[model samples]
Target: EEVKEKAQDVKKEAEVKAEEVKEEVKEKAQAVKEEVKEEVKEEKAEIENKIASTGNYPDLITSLKNNPWTSGDLNTRVKFEDIRRQVTLHEEEITDLPLDKIKTSLSPESLVDFLNMTSAKPTILNRKEDTSYEFTTRDPKEIDLIKKRYGLLDREIDKITSVLIFDKEGQKLKEVKDVLAEGKNRIYMETKF
Candidate 1:
């Protein structure tokens, strides 16, 4: 009995730490998004300057290919003719370079797994009694903070509009830097301990 209780306590603590890491991942993702935006802007400006300096079709084509710039939605390898037609028709936004597709698409919850917060077995979350049916936290400090932030004191629970449960299935790969198309479901757990 004592061993079982200790194991539960450890699992709970690990889960709490995972939640904290998830928040950190969100912050990092936002930062990465900002950095990628700046880099793309710089790359686009440099390419545009080069193209303007060329002042000739042949030189422009060479500059386009050598510079390695791409329209956000276009293929990795684009011809000068295709670029000219696209620009003429205004069908594409060539200046907008989406360099970090993964960072933009990936949810913060999934990023936590990539960060490898710890070798935590999430079986502790399998118990039904451990889940939240509402957006309320059980922690006194967090609850107080939320109440203060939202300016709600002793507010009664209004009827729930909807509860959505998203299920995620994936194997945590080791030493992988590839972008994952999908994301994991975040477990928002609030404990009194």
Candidate 2:
């Protein structure tokens, strides 16, 4: 009878130990499940942020396609739209150059091409505060039109004895004596400082 009692006590202890182990395993499983849930939530949030950041491309491309000014052959329009998207995306990286009184201008088509060419990466040089801007276009006619419209300064360097400055309407603003004969042309004849 004593042996039977001892055996029963031992059996009870083993059952208690088994229950404790089962509870511990259940707690561990719950912790693991919670960890997985948190990780999934974090991943989902990252994906949402990524989508928000880049979601404007499709809509912008659509707008470009529908734009009357940009309309053309389907292939060409598509190429331009792609370039436009790249430009818009990286516009913040392009430096804002301080412009002077000499307003530089370019045709719409040429400007689009230039932007497309430089959209991959942007590198703009910082100029002095009083720097004037001079623009050159491949079309000489366009240059003349811009000069007429914006009163841009004209600098001549081919054995010219004088430099002439003209207003927007071709009126002579000033004529400066060119003392240096090195053929170095200057658009702005005088510095403010």
Candidate 3:
């Protein structure tokens, strides 16, 4: 009977020890879970900044204003909608150049083509803050970029005649030319900074 009693005592102690170990394991798991939640909370804001917002001029305004990527003299990544425009940045030199009022020396080969263009009064869709933009015309030759009211950066569009799409390795992907189409005609081009 004494031997049986000792065995029962040992069994009771073993069960208590097992319960204590189980509770310790649960506590450690809860601590790890809390640590993980804290890490995600810390990274949430930074991750939100990297997420890109894509839309037309109005939709992009908020993104540009809040962009964390744009610091002093840092190049910002931008893209225009299909056929409307797209801005893929290359070359790392950052310059905020100021231009004096002067006629551009660089002439486009399509200048002769532009002479035949009908007179147009287009409502400009681009803002001065935009890194790149496109001008789409509803009617034939109805878009004119030469405006006295445009800011210095906006006037840079006058210098660009065509867009040459290139891959990362400098291989030419596509070249946009001055073409008159039946539907919306776009002058998709890139102005070099």
Q: lDDT (CA) for every model shown?
A: 0.32, 0.33, 0.34
On lDDT, the stronger of 1 and 3 is: 3
Q: State the lDDT of candidate 1 residue by residue for 1-193, as single tens digits.
A: 9999999999999999999999999999999999999998887776544443222223323323343423232222111113323322121433222323321332222222212222222221222323211222233443333232223334332211111121121111111122111112111111111
Candidate 2 wrong stretches, greater than 4 Å:
53-193
The alpha-carbon lDDT assigned to residue 97 of candidate 3 equals: 20
Clashes of each: 0, 0, 2
TM-score of 1: 0.28
Quote the positional error of residue 185 for candidate 2 in Å: 52
Please give the lDDT score at residue 170 for candidate 2.
26
Poorly placed runs, candidate 1 (over 4 Å): 53-55, 58-193
lDDT, candidate 2, residue 50? 32
Best by lDDT: 3
Looking at candidate 1, what is the lDDT of residue 151?
33
**Residue range 1-193, candidate 3, lDDT tens digits:** 9999999999999999999999999999999999999987665565454333333332333332232221132222212222434332222321322212212211221221232242332233333433222233433233332222112333223232222222233222222222222122222222221
